[model samples]
Target: MDRIQEIVDFWFLPESDENYGKQREVWFKKNPDFDAEVRGKFLEDFEKAEAGELLHWSESARGSLALILLFDQFTRNMFRDSPRAFAADGKAREIARHMLSCGFYDELNTVEKQFAALPFEHSEDMDDQKLSVKLFEELGSGEALDYAQRHLEIIERFGRFPHRNEQLGRESTKEEEAFLKTPNSSF
Candidate 1:
């Protein structure tokens, strides 16, 4: 299979309890091998996709999701702890919004929809955070909804994610510093 198909297949495995647990393990945990694999396999495609050269991928739901994964998820793994990790966030958010506007988002399963909604959830913008909460709620994703709500609450209080201060080079406020000490303050 092509790289895009490979990503789609790996990410959207058949829905089963064991598969879901494995998916969460990959999604939430840090694994150097998996990170290295994404870096080695998809880094070039990620660059091309970020440059807007892969517009054709938006022609279908699966393809669009793959593009989003490249922009949002893979970037984090490939460029961890650098500002470059967030460089493609705007493109990811754009693709996600396009997917929603084009009705492609409705074609996704719950797990897929959660990922498609993640760009918004990851945004610092309040409106985007609100939309993320709404989307998670609509999807009936209990854990995701809880996190989305927490993200929205943080955005409401701080205007931006304080956890990003160190990586983005923005100085955190004293209050933000205290909040950062709390567990789960940063997603």
Candidate 2:
């Protein structure tokens, strides 16, 4: 398979296999450098898109940029062993920084906008959650309200995502899992 398809598969593999999440821990433990290798590949893809070399999988620059950011964030969370993984202190700021430079937020539709705000609200900043809530409210959709409520809850408490324990390779507590199930979790 082509490289892009491989990344795409990597992005969704866990959804396809219930064992995939646990299995990934095994693979990465054997090759701790793999995460950096994957990040390099993502940077290459982003650069290629900048040079107008992207093909087949997507046609829009915005979609491509969002996908890169999404997977970048996801991989960092999933593969905590990655040397380049985002740290807790400034993770949200890093994502928001990327989003600012993305230069294509306005091009997204309402639904896409909601999904695109993941990096912001899911950040370490409580204000990012407010921004996310406002953005979702602007969409005026029921799904958005659900998201707004969830973001509010996070902002009210941790000011960051807690259900991330599983992906961060820590066992999630019962309270954490209960919190995850109660609202709109990333899972």
- Name the top TM-score candidate: 1
lDDT of 2 by residue, 58-87 (tens): 444344434544344444644454333544
lDDT of 1 by residue, 5-94 (tens): 777776665344357523467776678888888799889999888777888999999899999999999999888888988889999999
Query: What overall lDDT goes with each candidate model?
Result: 0.88, 0.53
Highest lDDT against the true fold, candidate: 1
Q: With candidate 1 superimposed using the best TM-score fit, by how many Å does residue 41's alpha carbon deviate from the native? A: 1.3
Model 2 stretches astray by more than 4 angstroms? 1-64, 67-103, 166-187
Q: After superposition, how far is residue 145 of candidate 1 from its true place, in Å?
A: 0.3
Candidate 1 residue spans exceeding 4 A from truth: 14-22
How accurate locally is residue 19 in candidate 2, as Cα lDDT from 0 to 100? 49
TM-score of every candidate relative to the true structure: 0.93, 0.47
For model 2, where is the 10-residue window of minimal lDDT?
A: 19-28
lDDT of 1 at 154: 96
- Scanning candidate 1 in windows of ten residues, the lowest lDDT window is 14-23
